[model samples]
Target: MSIQVGDRLPEVVLKRIHEGIESVDTRALFDGRKAVLFAVPGAFTPTCSEKHLPGFVEHFQQFRDKGIEVACMAVNDPFVMQAWAKSQHVPEGMMMLSDGNGDFTRALGLELDASAYGMGLRSKRFALYAEDGVVKQLHVEAPGEYKVSSAEYLLESL
Candidate 1:
């Protein structure tokens, strides 16, 4: 089943290119703070690059001002995520997470099979708000739609 409000985020390790491809544990990352984790189907895709990530990068301060840490996740490897972040000028503290194996995406039941489009297993466009590891809000976009999970929408909903 897909994760819902009130569900605790599953235990999973996601990667990021910090010093050198650091591993981040979900529980440790969200256990003591409020955080917004937004997932993209793939990094550098049209919609993802043109709109999705830019919105988050633009409004990253607002979320932080409200005491929430923001993270962007994708099924791509940490190297791709790092390149995308640099190209987009993503803020320093905003995390770029890589679910390379799709393990975390499957664990959340949010995996998307985009094989027909030449992309293999991936994550749906979705965002969730969690406090101390418990989900408080989840915005999962319909297939091929981008509305609820947008940074503006998530900000207003908060």
Candidate 2:
């Protein structure tokens, strides 16, 4: 089953373009802070590029104002995540995490198989709120649908 409210996030290493593809530990990122980690199946796909990530980019300050740090996760490499951040005009302080090998995705039980579409292992579209390492709220989208995971919806929920 997927990670639920009250579950402590599994420890994993994710990559980001901080001075050139730094590896970050999940515990260090989430522990002792309020954070929202939202995942997309793949970077630059239509829905994810046009709407999902942009919503977060547009609302990044709002989330920060509430004392919650935001991070966007995808199954792409750190390079792609970096490029996407640039393309989206993502502001600083919002993390663009690269799952790279889907290890973290599988640990959370949120892995998506897209072999038929030529993409292999990926993450399902989802967003989760956590406080000090434990999940407080999670909104995972139904396949081929989008709603609860949007930044606007998550802001309203908070």
Candidate 3:
């Protein structure tokens, strides 16, 4: 079953690009905080690069102002995620987390199989608002749809 409001996010390790090599615990990222976590199919893809990620990047400050931490996840390597964040001009305070092995995605029961497109296992586009590691709301997009996971949707939900 898909994760829902009131669910505690699973514990998973994610690779992060920091000063050197750094691994982050997914639960630790959300523990004791309100956070908006969004997942995309891949990094550097057209919609993700042009719209999905930019929407969050543009509204990151507003999210923080509302006392929420914002994070983006993709089933790509840390190096690729880092490059994509730089290319998208991600501001400080927004985290671009790499679910490189898809462990986190699977743990959330949100993994998408896109092998037909040669993308392998990926994440469905979705957003979640969580408080102290428990989800408060979830917005999961229908396949090929982008209506629900946008920054506007998240802001309104908040």
Stretches of candidate 2 above 4 Å error?
A: none
Clashing pairs in 3: none
The worst-scoring run of ten residues by lDDT in candidate 3 lies at: 19-28
Predicted structure 3: lDDT: 0.93
lDDT of each: 0.97, 0.96, 0.93
TM-score of 2: 0.99
What does candidate 3's lDDT look like per residue over 1-158, in tens digits? 88888899999999989886579997789999999999999999989988999999999999999999999999999999999999999998799899999999999999999999999999999999999999899999999989899998999978
Ten contiguous residues minimizing lDDT sum, candidate 2: 14-23
**What ranking emerges by lDDT with the best candidate at the front?**
1, 2, 3
Candidate 2 per-residue lDDT over residues 1-158, each given as its tens digit: 98989999999999998998799999999999999999999899999999999999999999999999999999999999999999999999999999999999999999999999999999999999999999999999999988999999999999
Candidate 1 residue 69 C-alpha distance from true site, Å? 0.3
Q: Can you give the lDDT of residue 63 in candidate 2? A: 98
Model 1 Cα lDDT, one tens digit per residue, 9-73 = 99999999999989999998899999999999999999999999999999999999999999999
Query: What TM-score does each of the candidates earn?
Result: 0.99, 0.99, 0.98
Model 1, global lDDT: 0.97
